[model samples]
Target: MSGREFDLVLYGATGFTGLRTCQYLARNYKQGVRWAIAGRSASKLEEVREKLVNIDPGLSTLSIIQADASSPESLEAMAARTKVVISTVGPFLKHGEPLVAACVKQGTHYVDSTGETPFVLDIIRKYHKEARDKNIILVPECGFDSVPSELGTKMVVDFLRKEYNLPTKSVKLSVTKLRGAVSGGTLASICEVMEGKEGGMKDTLDQNQLVPEDVASKVVPARITLPSVFYDHDFKAWQAFFIMSFANEKIVKRSHGLAVEADGVGYGPEFTYRESMSAPGFFTAALASLGMGLGGAALSVGPLRRFIQNRILPAPGTGPSDESITQGHFTVKIIGESSLPENVPADASADALKPIKAIATIQGGEPGYSETCRYLVEGALCLVQNEDRVRNENKITGGVLTPAYAFGHILIDRLRAQNVNLTVSKL
Candidate 1:
C-alpha cells in the first residue's frame, strides 16, 4: 500500500456528500496526506478540486481521477491508485458492488456511507473471506446510518468490561436529539429499500441477518419487541422507532457476531440491542411513529413512490443548504447493562444484585451530512494512520466490517479530536 499513488481517493466526489468530504479534507489537509477526488465526470471532479483549492491554495495540486461506477475497468484503475477509497456513491444496492470488488482485487481498504442493509449483507457474504485473506478491510455505514449507534455501543461495552470486569447483557440506544434534513442520496436509498429492489425489505427484518451463518446459527435471538411508541426509563423520554434503527441495529449486531467469531466473546453471550428516537411527549412520540409508518407504507406503493421521488424529494447530488447543515445536530445515548457478576453472593441485597450499567453519548452537528463527512473522512484517516495496529494489534484480518469492528477506539479517538463528541460513564 505504501507504493500506491495516493493515500486516499474520494469517489463520487461530485455528489453533495462527496463534495463536502473534499471540503473537509481541504480544511483539515495535513502536509503529508496525499489525496485525490474521483468521479464519472472529469469536469465535476475538477470543479470540486477548484473548490478545495479555494479553501486551501495548498490543494491546488490535488489530483483528480475520472471513474464511473458502471465501468469495472475504471473502478479497478481507481482502486489501484489509492491505498484507501471513500465512496459516497449510493443507493448502494444499485451501484456499489463493482467498486468494492475492485478494492478487494487490488487489496485496497474501502469505506462508504450506505444505510442499505441488504447490500451490506450481500457484500459480506460475497467478499468477506477474500478480503480477509488479502488483509484489506471493507467497511460500510461509516456515516450517520450506524457510526454513532455502533461505536456508541462499543464505548459502553468497553467501559463495563475494562472498568468493572463485567460482560454486557443488553444495550439500548436512543436518539435523544436529532435536527437534520435528508439528502437526495439518502432518499434514493430509502426508496430502493421500500420498493423491495435487490433483496427486498424482508431481508432487513431478520435481526441477525448480517451476522455470519456459523455465528448466527449459535446465537440466541432476543425476544423483546419494542412497540411503535413507548416510554424509556433510562433516557427518561418518550420514544419512537428511529428511522435508521433497522440499519443501525443490524450493523451493531454484526460487529458483536464478528467479535465473538474472532475471540469467542463479544459484548456477551446474551447481549441484546435496540434503538429508538426521543420525543417531548407521548403524543409527539406516537405521531412520529405514525408518520414513519405511513411514510414507509406510502413509499412501498409504486405510484406514490414515483411521485415522491420525482416531485417531492431533492434530486441526487443536491441536499440541504449550508445554513441548514450548520444548524442541524444530533445526540445518541447508549446504555449497556450487565448481569450480576458470578462472585456475587445469593444473599446479596436486592440493590446490590441489580445489573451494573454504563451510559455513553455521541454528539455532533448535522448528522446526515456535516458530521457524517467527519465520520467518513476520519474513518479513512484511522485506516491510513493506524493500519498496523488494526491488522496486527487488533488481529483483524480484513473483512466486510462494521466501523466498531474495523477501527474501534482509534476511530473514536479521531472523531473526538474532530469534536464529534463521544463520552462514557458508569451509571
Candidate 2:
C-alpha cells in the first residue's frame, strides 16, 4: 500500500457526481490522505481541482491525472498508481468494463456508483474469478440504488443469527421517505435502461442474472407486483412500486445467494426479498403507483421515449441547485422475518412458533447526490483502510460484489461514524 503513489483516485471527476465527490474528499480528508482526481480531459480535471481549491485552499497542490475509459492503457496506468479507484461513471454498462479489467490486472480495489444490474451481473460472470484470484475487490452500487438494501438487510440477517439462532425466511424493505434531486448522469443511466438496447432495461430486470449461474436456476425470489398498491399491516403504511426496485431486489437476493453458497444457512434456504415505497395513505399510494405505471409504459414506447429524452429529463451533466442537494434526505426500513429450524417439535405452541422479526432502519442525506457521494467516498476509504478486515473477518477477498457483500460491517461502521443514521431493533 505504501508503494502506491496515491491511496485513491477519483475517476470521472469532471462529471457532476464526481466533482462533488472530490469536494467531499477535500473537505473531509484533510489529514494527508494521498489522492488524485482523473478524467478524460486534463483541462477539465484541473478546472475541477480549482473548484476544490475553493473548498480547501491546500488542495491546490492535489495531483490531477488524465485517464479515459476508452483507453485501456490509460485506465491500467491509473489503476496501477492507486490502491483504490472510485468512479462516478455511468451508465456503467458502456464505460465501466475497461476500468474494471484494468483494476483486476493491477490488483487495484474498485468501487462505483452504478445501479445497472445487467452490468454488474456481466462483470460477475466475466471477472469474478479473476478478481478473486488476484485478490482485488470490485464493488458496485455504493450509492443509493442498493446500499441500504444490501447492508441494512445484512444487519438484520446478522442480528437474527446472533439473537434468535434462526435463518431469515423473508425480508421486506420499504422506502418510507426519500427526498432528492437527480443529476444528468442519473437521468442518462435511467434512459439507457429504458432505451430498449442490447443490455437495456428489459434484460437488466432479469433477477436470475443477479445470482451465480449455479444458484440462478435454483433460487426463485418471492415476487411482488408493482404499480399495484397494497397495505403492509406490519409497517401500517401503503406500499407501492419503487423505481429502484428492479435493481435493489435482485442485489439483495444475490447477497443471500452468495452467503448461502459460502455457508449452509445463508439468509435462509428459502430466503425471499422484496422492496417498495411506503405511501402515507391509500390514495397517495394509488396515485404514485398509477403515475409510475404510466411513466414506465410511456418510456417503453418509441415516441414517448423520444419526448422524454428531449424535454422531460435533464441532460447528462447537469444537476440540481446546492440548496436542493443539501435539503435532500432518505429513509429505508428493512424487516427480516425469522423461522425456527424444521426439526422443531410439531407440538410447539402457536406462540412458540410465531415468527421473530428483526428490523433495521437506514436513513441518510439525499439518496442521489450528496449522500451518494458520501457513501461512495466512505466505501473507498473503507477499502483502503480496512481491506484486511474485509478479507479476514468477512472472508470476502475478491469478486464482483454488492456493497454489503464487499464492505459489510466495516462500511456500516464507517457510515455511522460519518453520521449516516443506521440502527437495528427488535419489532
Best by lDDT: 1
**Candidate 2 wrongly placed segments (more than 4 Å):** 197-205, 221-225, 341-349
Error of 2 at 405 (Å): 1.0
Q: All models: lDDT?
A: 0.87, 0.85
Tens-place lDDT digits, model 1, residues 194-262:
777433455556678787777885555733443489898889999998878888888998999998898
**lDDT against true structure, model 1:** 0.87
Displacement of residue 90 (Cα, Å) in model 1 is 0.9
In candidate 2, which residue pairs clash? none
